[model samples]
Target: MALTPLSWCVGAALALVCGSSWPKMHSALAPENEVPLRPTTWLPEGKITSVTLPKGKTRRLYFTLKKASAMSVTISPCDLPIEWSLAARTLKDKPLKSLHWTTKKSMPEVWWRGPGTEEKIHSFTGDAVNTFSGPSHPRTSIYILRLRSKQQSTRATVYLHEGPGPSGTFPLLPADSNVHTLGVGMTSVTLSWAPSPSTTSLHNAENSYNYCVLVNSLQNYPSLCAAKVSMRKEKDQKQDKKERRVTVWPILKEWWWQQWDTYPEDQSPSASLEDEYDDLQCVCDGTDSVCTVSELLPDTQYYFDVFVIDRLNGTNAAYKGTFARTHEEARPAITSLREGELRWVTFGDLRSNSEQFFSFRPRGWQQSGLLTLQSCGGGDKVKVTVSSKGQVLTSQGVGGDLVHIWLQGSPSYLIHLEREGSTTGQISSVKDQALPGALMASVKMQISSAYHRRGVPSLPSTLQIKSFNRLRGCSSVTLAWMGTEERSLYCVYRRKLEKLEAEGVSTLTAPCLGPESRSDTERVLCKYFQELNPRRAVTTAVIGGLEPGRAYVFDVYLMRRWGIPIKYASKMVKTRKEC
Candidate 1:
């Protein structure tokens, strides 16, 4: 069922009049003179009491009813009742955006589904509106809204009727002088009248108020209007001053834009920017200050000067600056095989003369230096070295200080480098894929000694082990060997692999090397080993608890002797748990 828009059909059918006869449900709800409606309802089950519809920026309805909440009845397009349809035709007004009829039952999902959710037309079945529930209170509807001020007209009409509905028509608002303060405490004020005398968005109404105080005191007349307007004009003048003055950014030499700002007021203007930064770039874009140099490659150094003309001052202001070259010349980072196949890489090293520019030989210490890729991915083991080999193109001369990195043929690995480095320009990295060159992989004699000289002993000296078994496993049958682990305080650990589980070492003895002992020492060692095998290696040394009847796992190792490898027994065994 649909209700009609608020209005009466002049020459339409008699039954078409709002609240005319309850003979049948109306398709629409138009304004009714008076009609009987049911009482004791949250919505206007009966005719709604006359409501005053305010106008202007704010428009709303106010009905004097004994209900805690309200349901905004509406005349939807479809299913308009006979009377509703007639009233709708008679009334001409703004088109509707959305309208919904609701009942209390649908309150919970109201905020979610919104106003027009119900399907069946009108008759106020308490459809969706009944469902619209809020904090036991409904937000007052505000319409005729002004976006900027959010102001609405205060004039709208309301229909009053007897419930089970109303009997006759009546204006809800009584004539009263409504005075709202405008620009309180200010000399000048703006006032507006709501429910504009002329209705609609295009028609604006002028509602004026006379200030009693200003009228009584003629002395302050200038302060209230005309003079105040003059003051406002002056205020605007001050604001425009900012637009008149233009500040110039300092010029820098080098190609990149300098990463900096003008010096603080206290800092000397002529103070040295010598090493502050070398990053700056500028585009003169063909103006009077049009760049003397037009075309340039990316990340290149540049210095420029422009004679800025001051239209107001009629003078030339010189803007000069310098900046360094951007990173146009990039060498693949230093990352390569730590072992396996060798992939050669170079950074800041010797280059053939043809590819040289302001070349300077790298220092002696730099010969063995490693360059950080800043970010490297996969197994990209890299080494830095100078090659006098003939791999230079005649035109591209390499400089002594420049390290021209050539991906020697296609290697087996495709390395991806992540973004790496410090905020302050550190080093650069590259993503590369290449095949292995004739310079096959080999264990460098120098590197072997280098590792040893660094106090790193051979792997054969200590049998601490890469792992007892799989780095991630919990089976108890496993055994660990020890290399030179005689003095090593050995312990065993167990935990559910993959799943989070507690790991510890404990003690329980069964068989040694499979029911037989290699020596008296083996027996004692094995016995003690069982005693402390499952102790909480990190927290305690109870040489603690172990499942008495199950064979517990153990790992053997010597502490601080990591660089050395110690010999090991095949597999020290423990018997089933006795418990």
Candidate 2:
């Protein structure tokens, strides 16, 4: 016969056991003797079935346990006394624990004794219960379900269910090794490491993983910490807080600003997201084992570390940290020259349309100054414009060399040169003729002002402080100056702006009183001084070890041969806060 409907068998069994007339068998029924049973045949969880039972016959079914720790089976509405048993065996056919049950007053419920406490089994008339509980054992195991009846022909339905498997935790993987710096530069470093041993295993167990390279400052700069600021994504917020902790310093703002100095293109009002992303320091692929970190400060020491993060498990492991230092900045070359008694200052391969600025203070009875430009090569013609304090001087369509003389007026001037096409060349002062090789394009100037007689004492031209650049988060400042005189000594002095102001002294006038003639306040605060070489027409000084977040006044003095002060210049600047 074909298999019977389990619902029909259950209903019929209930009526027969209750003393009512036997119900008709389901149209589709299969004899117990004919039902297929095998040692490897396993029913899916929550499966139910019904079959006709021949007198004194038995049938068995099999299932494999994986991750699951226990198994349960139930039989209900049986017309005859039927017995059911469940047994477990290892993959090698070794027998484990076994259980048996028979029909009772109510439906029977049975479960394995594993992971959880034993549950009370409830039974009713015309029902059978069978359950097997035990350790799932190592690896995999097979389970067998056996059913039999001793009385006359009857049918019963069997229902099977399995408990969930145990939950697993992330495994501890080996950390990365052989971490080293591949390359270093003034503002960037490349790093590499051996593939993490646990990488492959993690990939097999999880969907994905990523490598995170961290850099910290080894020096006094607090902003250089390894766990400091970095490019982050919104999705990272979901990660555990411990995995996201990073050390940061307020001065980092200046460091980052210096790293990515504003470019002309970026400064435009119409910038886009794509542009911003492209301008980011460095973007390494998540899957890459090596990465480059950029936007770093020059001449700085930093500690680097590499770590792996399991995306699926949200855990991180770090490699050993390494140290690296960036190279120092290169200085520009300078050539000195003289025209009669006046010294001419010059330098550069000034590009077309690019402007150069210089500050100068003429003597008390100064008259005029001469500006000269000579093309080294490239373009055929050039246009040079010199402007100062509302006064303008333009020389256009000139080839080879050009000269423009003007009466001294303002204390500063801006020079701009342009060419017709995309040609490159250099321009320098007429006095540079003494130099042999082709001169790099440059602009030179010599002021023809009134001067003191032979042995007479007189002050040098006023000192001119040109530019001041403060390094972010550090106690350092780079100062550039012009209007330096030959045969004269130059001294740079700096002091706290607050102290200078409190003493009712100004850097411009204080130095004129001679170093010893100053009051205790002026002498105490302005004690830091450095003598610059007189040969340098244009000079740049890097002053470090200043107090952060404080303002200071700087003075540059031009001293005569007799040790008498001539002229002095001053400027004020503030240093970045913490870094």
Best by TM-score: 2
lDDT (Cα atoms) of all candidates against the true structure: 0.24, 0.46
Segments of candidate 2 deviating more than 4 angstroms = 1-179, 202-207, 215-288, 295-303, 328-330, 339-370, 374-579
Q: Write the per-residue lDDT of candidate 2 for residues 266-336, one digit (tens) a residue.
A: 34212222233233343333446678877778998877766554433333344666879998786333222
RMSD of each: 33.0, 26.8
- Measured by TM-score, how close is model 1 to the native structure? 0.17
- lDDT string for model 1 (401-466, tens) is 112232222112223222111134422221122111222111110110021122222222323333
TM-score of each: 0.17, 0.29
The regions of model 1 sitting more than 4 angstroms off are: 1-302, 305-455, 460-480, 484-545, 561-579
Model 2 worst lDDT window (10 residues):
104-113
